[model samples]
Target: MASQKPFIAEHIYADAQTGSTPILLIHGFNSNGAQDWDGQQWLAPLKAAGRKIIVVDLPAHGESARVDVPEDATVSKIVATLSEIIDNHGGKADVVGYSLGARLAWALASQRPERVNKLVLGGLSAGDPFAMLDYDAARKFADEGVTPEDEMTAMIASMAMGEGKDSHSLLNLMQGLGREPFDPSVEKPAAPTLLAAGLEDPMAGSVDAIEPFLDNNKTVRVPGDHFSALKSDAFKQETFAFLGIAH
Candidate 1:
């Protein structure tokens, strides 16, 4: 069991540049900013392009920081933290979020459109099953590495654990997200955004399920599933191009 005490999110800046509008990178569940961006080799190129990269370790993933409160891992809270980051760096920047990070990005752009310039939401879909899960039961099943009754949730749990996440902490993350149906009633994310999904990736959900609800959007299909897609150079190409910093 890891420390449950709330803490500040860990973040790193690449090539700190004054007055240069930064681009924020948010990683997926069980993964940290280093693994998703720097480890994946995305950081160097963006740095070379003279872009300031602000990579965040979304609570308890990389650099092991917790939210302000144990129960504050919700998208709203995540966005609030992110807003603070953007504020510190001049209050408006582009954003790139992967998987679970993408979900939080959606909430951020929808709720704080002015804070985002160009948005790239990678690995997302219409519904989030984690919201429907029984946190306690799922956490227990995950600890055992098996949930016979619900294969999907079990696999998701396994994936989270595979990323080196403690089962209970991951459960806390999902719980902060709460169990709420996808809300289209909220204002659509107005930022210039791209929805990037891999054809083979069902784990990230379906782009079809929610793309229709978003305006000011472009869609791109890269060559790998959830994890691999992020590792793909094509994915990087798409991202760089969408961010308008592509070579």
Candidate 2:
């Protein structure tokens, strides 16, 4: 893993030895790149398949420095950051994002269609209704100086997990994100795209909410809830196949 200072910002990277097709992996809210990918065992198979990988920690998360433009830092900032990394590596690359990362991926694919070759969005939808409520609640929490360890965070975890269990880690993450709007509008993507969510993910709820936003893109539903989606081997295979990398 290497630390990259691009766009005057610091982010972590894990390069693949074979470097076949470059794929950028973006982590979810409150989670770092390694914690998201490594914890789920998603990166190893991609590496073994000879695919170059790039993982980034979003602003206010992981080793990346906090941005002064938290309110201004919409999903577009994430897209620009990935664009900068892809440009530094080459000109274009495939992108894979989970949760909040997936939301950013959608924004990136919509904004800079040419910069991304392929895209995979996991555990989220472009205009998920649940996300709007979360956005409001998170903003309120941030205003109240509440950290991720707050009751609201546990509620979110319970909802996303669909098991009615509280997660301290999830609360800490919500606090880390501070307050940001969750806005996912319809945008045409220039590359092949895939949208995925856990079958029981309360956050995503149903595929119906996402279908209208996707421009005829592929959708995959794997077993489990938000946390378990990453653990699904079926998800890994489908994701790798979508990126055109052998599993």
Candidate 3:
């Protein structure tokens, strides 16, 4: 077996001039910072907030496509690397994350509470989606374009096959993430948080399930499904209010 390389994802500061405490945007599975935040039209509003912005492509995704994910890696390892992004900047940030990004944000806040000012965790649910992934089925679909029999794997395939996506690295990320499943009850963050989920998004089951895990938190149901929620105006409004950014 070949040894795995150290995990290093790509990150970029989006603003030309430095301003208030930075806002770090983390994208979800099968998506990159550009598609999730830039393409979804999130940067403009954030820029108007008059704060330094930092955007990151998670390991094995987006600009970080070449980054190798070790089979035994866990979310903690990624969170630690993300923490360095914060440390390299101003040593703290207000985080906004969706789906898998939200899961990682939660872990980052819990592990390093001092580094996070506030959190906007969107499209998060109760159970671990990675744990449910059919790895072999997902890989087959990725490598050979064979449709997966599993519903979740099929759904993932559709998203992973998008333009410029590295399906193989994404599958490897899923495999690593499945090794340590996400559980909201463990190691919670005390920072003020806003948990928003789309009303019709099945992936985010009962957003309130996560309320107990956060000390200062608010939960709201926004319009649209998982994908649409990222682009929803309601989501932006609620998050902006929580972060004290103007509408």
Candidate 4:
């Protein structure tokens, strides 16, 4: 995992010999780029198909710098960082994001439609302001030295899980750091998009609520609750297909 110093991103190059379209994978809250994709075995198929891949660790996660910003980090800051990465790689790249990362991806695509060739968002809802509010409160709790109850922790872990069991430490770190909520006033994405959620997920309501806002989008339901869905083969298949790669 080579580090990008100023941006705090971890670059993972694909093994494919030929140059191809690049795809950026953004992980969810509490989880870094590697943790999100490691269990799903997403890279192997993408690399096999000859696509360039770049996975990043946002501000507070993984090897990135833990900067002290507002409880809810601004979406513009994230977009700026992503834009810089795309520019460095030429001009544009496809993007796939899950949970918190998905929210950022949506903001980025909306802000710079030309920079994203294809976009996919999983485990998120555009209509849920409560989700954002909860994140803010959680961050406050972390700052105040309050430990979240077991139920609350379980609720947080339900967002996304791959192969390994959920880690309380990671969830606590993310909940405490907090994330910015989505602003509906932002422009909707114009790129080809795919939105997905787990069938038994509590967040499913949020995903359904936001469907109308996506200009060009398709939706899919996979097995398991929120966390379990991340490990689904169906998700990987659908994701690869949406990115125009042979699954």
User: Alpha carbon lDDT of residue 140, candidate 3?
Assistant: 84
The alpha-carbon deviation from the true structure for residue 60 of candidate 1, after best TM-score superposition, in angstroms, is 2.1
Q: What tens-digit string does per-residue lDDT give for candidate 3 at 1-247?
A: 9555335555554653455788899988877788888633677777766777788888776655353554535687788888998998889999999999998898999899989999999998778877888878887887788888988879865676766777777777777877778887768888899999998999896687778777799999999999999889899889888998876
Residue-wise C-alpha lDDT for candidate 2, range 147-242, written one tens digit per residue: 445564435544333233223334333433333444544365657878888999977665557666566589888988988896688777888788
Q: List, residue by residue over 1-247, the lDDT tens digit for candidate 4.
A: 9654454576777665445678899988767888888733888788888877889998666776654444333567768888888878767888999877788898889898889999988887554332333544444444554444554543554442334523333443354334444654556788898998999888654786777787789999988786777778888889988887997
Best by TM-score: 1
TM-score of 4: 0.78
Model 4 — which ten-residue stretch has the worst lDDT?
160-169
Q: After superposition, how far is residue 103 of candidate 3 from its true place, in Å?
A: 0.7
Candidate lDDT values, in order: 0.76, 0.65, 0.81, 0.71
* Candidate 1 lDDT, 64-158, residue by residue in tens: 55443436576676788889888888889898999888888888888888899988989986777776665555767766754646666666666
* lDDT of candidate 3 at residue 234, scale 0 to 100: 94
* TM-score of every prediction relative to native: 0.88, 0.73, 0.87, 0.78
- Please give me the total number of clashing residue pairs in predicted model 2: 2
Which is the winner by TM-score between candidate 2 and candidate 4?
4
Ranking by TM-score: 1, 3, 4, 2
Whole-model lDDT, model 1: 0.76
Give residue 31's error in model 4 in angstroms.
Answer: 0.6
